[model samples]
Target: MKVEFFFDVGSPASYLAWTQLPKICAAKGAELVFRPMLLGAIFQATGNASPAAVPVKGRHSGIDLGRFAKRYGVPLVMNPHFPVNTLQLMRAVTGVQMHQPERFEHLLKTLFDALWIDALNLNEPALIGRTLIRAGFSIDEILALANSPDVKAQLRSTTDEALERGVFGAPTCFVGDQMFFGQDRLDFVEEALA
Candidate 1:
């Protein structure tokens, strides 16, 4: 089965899904494709809102995410800088994908871990630069790609394509015509793959 995962760095649920889905796919002998999409754009196009927008759901999600983190044995924390505008971050993802495909995995892992595991405040460019540097990434190169017009267009086009795919949120996984939303749905995803 072919698995496509649509993600946004700013979403904690996306990070959780990232941690778990790869292992699931590997065990099932399925190929997992990581797709970086802009969650803000999806929400705008689909009239969806993050769980944070709702007080009860927001609190519950935090607890639920923690449970998943423990179950997966991966470090996770809600970023103190909640609501980080990941426009630049997502652009960097697209840029790496377009310019340096080899670095995509490392870049994705580094940024996802920074945003969710370390719970760093990635809202500031300066902090991002430092974080990238620590992750052994070229700060200049990534920033340049992130700021370029082509990269911006790539992110836009990817977001547009995601909207067309019935995706209204992050961590959406597809197995052919079957679409599963949320990290909690990995069991069903595994079933689909089988």
Candidate 2:
């Protein structure tokens, strides 16, 4: 089975999905492809804002996310500022995937945790470098790729592709013709697998 996960670093829900759903897919022997998208574009098209922008939903989502985090033992650092720009982080993910797949996953998770859970600004080069190093990644390699024109192009291209594919939200899962939206819909994904 194949599962394509459309995500953005700025989405807390995407971070939650990233931390948890991989285990489920792996257990089913499914191939997981991470598709990084631009949340800003998606929101602009849909006339939507960050969950934090919506008072009620934002409060509720925080509660719900807390449950998932505690259940999965995933520490979430709720960024008080909300919606930090992730252009560099997204490009870095693609670059990391190219140079080191395993470490890429590790760094992605680390960065997500630090941003969503620790509320750190991932856009800063120094902070990003520190996160990578803390995750046991080669800072030099990551910074080199993060600055590479090719990686930047890949990130931009990938974002365009994601938009063209009709992805308008984070945590959108594509399983063949089935499109599952939000982390709450993972049960549907499991059912589809079964």
Candidate 3:
């Protein structure tokens, strides 16, 4: 089985999913495919509003996410800058996947940690550049690739494809034709994999 993970860095739940899915895939001997798509686009396409848009749900979600993080034994600090424009970050994901495939994993980890673990304001170009450099990526090269028309098109197509696949949210995992939404659904994911 191959697990297709559609995720965006801006979603805390996506980060929570990221913490566990890899290990599950590895243990199950399934190939893990990372699909980078913009959550904002998905929301627009599906007419889905963020869970955080509702104040009560947002507070409950924070506690729920923290519980999951504790269960997963991963660091989880909600970004103080709640709604980061991760356009460049998401673009960088596709760019690395396209150009520097070897660096994709490093890039993903760095960006995820910066936003969720370190809680950095990553939408700022300066911090993004510094973060990439520290992650052993060339700022100029990466930014160049990220800003390219091809990369932009790739992200757009991916987001469109996600919407077509009935994906209305991030951290969606597909086991063959079966779709599981949210990190909370990992048990079902594992069952389908089995």
Candidate 4:
């Protein structure tokens, strides 16, 4: 079996899912395909806003996410810069995944750790450059690829495909045609893999 993980590095929930899905797929002897999509585009296309758009729901969601983080024994510090614009970040991700598949997982880990675990404000270009440099990535190469027309088009196509797959949010997992919407629904994903 294979799990198509449609994700954006900007979403904390997607970071949580990223921490768990590898283990889940490993135990199930399943392949985990990383489908990097633009979450902002997904929201705009679907007319679905982040839970943070609603103050009460955002607070509740934060608490719930904390519970999950504790349950998973993983660190998740909500970025003070919540809702960071991730257009270039996602494009860089797509570019890396396309040009250097081997470094793809490393890049994901570095970015996720920066945003969720370290609580870095990745929305700032200088900070992002420093973070990537610290992670041993060449910022110049990343920038060149991220700004390339091919990378931009590929990210857009992936986001469009995600929309067609009924994906309205990040951390969406597909076990065959079974669409699981949140990191919290990973149990269902495991069952589907079984």
Candidate 5:
């Protein structure tokens, strides 16, 4: 079986999913395909805004995220910079996944850890550069790839494909055609995998 994980690194829920999916897939003997898409574009196209857009929902979401993190025995600190513009970040991810497939998992771990575990303000370019370097990535190479037209188009295409598949948010997974939204729905995902 295969689990198509449609994700955006900017979403905390996505981070939570990332932490658990590998183990779930491993136990199920399933392949986990990472589909990196632009969340901002997904939101714009679907008229769906981040939970943070609504104050009450945002606060409750944060608390719920904490509860899940605890349940998963994983660390999650909400970034002070709640909504970092991730256009370039997503592009970088797509670029790496396309051009340097070997480094894809490392890049995901680095960025997710920075934003969710370490609570780094990745909105700042310098900070992003430092984080990439600390994670053994080449900033220049990443920048060149991220700026390439192909990478931009791939991200767009992936986001459009996600919308067409009825995905309006991040961390969506598919077991065959069974679309499961949210990390909280992972139990359904596991059942579908079975």
Candidate 6:
């Protein structure tokens, strides 16, 4: 079985879900297919803004995120700067996934840590290269891959496909024909595997 994970590096909830999903997939003997999609387009297509844009949801989301983090023992730092632009990070992720999927997972985890925990700005190429290098990839390779026209095109194509598929949010998981949304719904994913 395959679980197609639709995610973006910019989303805190997507970060949380991505961190936990590997273990879940492993236990279920399911293949986790990471599908990097542009969350911005997803939001725009659905005529929806981020949770932070909603007054009530934004306020409660923090508390909920903290609780979810604690429940899973995943660190959640709630960056003071709500939404950080992650276009570069997303492109870099596409590059990694194209060349080194295994390394991509580690790079992704570190990127998430930088985004949600350390609250580091990923817009700087130096920071992104450092993060990738620290995860055991050559900075030059990452830079080269990010500059590849193929990777750039793939990101755009994937984003467009995701929007057309009616995906309007980050952290959505598809198990065969069933669609499950949110990190909180991992239980449903587990049950589906059962």
lDDT of 6 at 136: 80
- lDDT tens digits, residues 1-194, model 1? 77999999999989989888878999999999878889999999899999988989998999999999999888998987898999999999999999999999899999988888788899988999999999899988998999999999988987898889899998899999899999899999999988
Looking at model 1, the pairs that clash are: none
Per-residue lDDT over 61-148 for candidate 6, one digit per residue giving the tens place of the 0 to 100 score: 9889899999989888888766867666787899989988878878887888888989777767787777777778787777777779
Q: Per-residue lDDT for 99-167 in model 5, tens only?
A: 999999999999999999899999999999999999999999999999999999999999999999999
Q: Per-residue lDDT tens digits of candidate 4, residues 1-194?
A: 99999999999999999999999999999999999999999999999999999999999999999999999999999888989999999999999999999999999999999999999998899999999999999999999989999999999999999999999999899999999999999999999998
How good is model 2 by TM-score? 0.87
Candidate 4 weakest ten by summed lDDT: 78-87
- Which portions of model 6 show Cα errors greater than 4 Å? none
Tell me the spans in candidate 5 whose CA falls farther than 4 Å from its real position: none
TM-score of 5: 0.98
Global lDDT scores for all candidate models: 0.91, 0.79, 0.91, 0.96, 0.96, 0.84
Which regions of candidate 2 deviate over 4 angstroms?
Answer: none
lDDT of 3 at 194: 88
Q: Point out the higher-scoring one by TM-score: 1 or 3.
A: 3
Ranking by TM-score: 4, 5, 3, 1, 6, 2
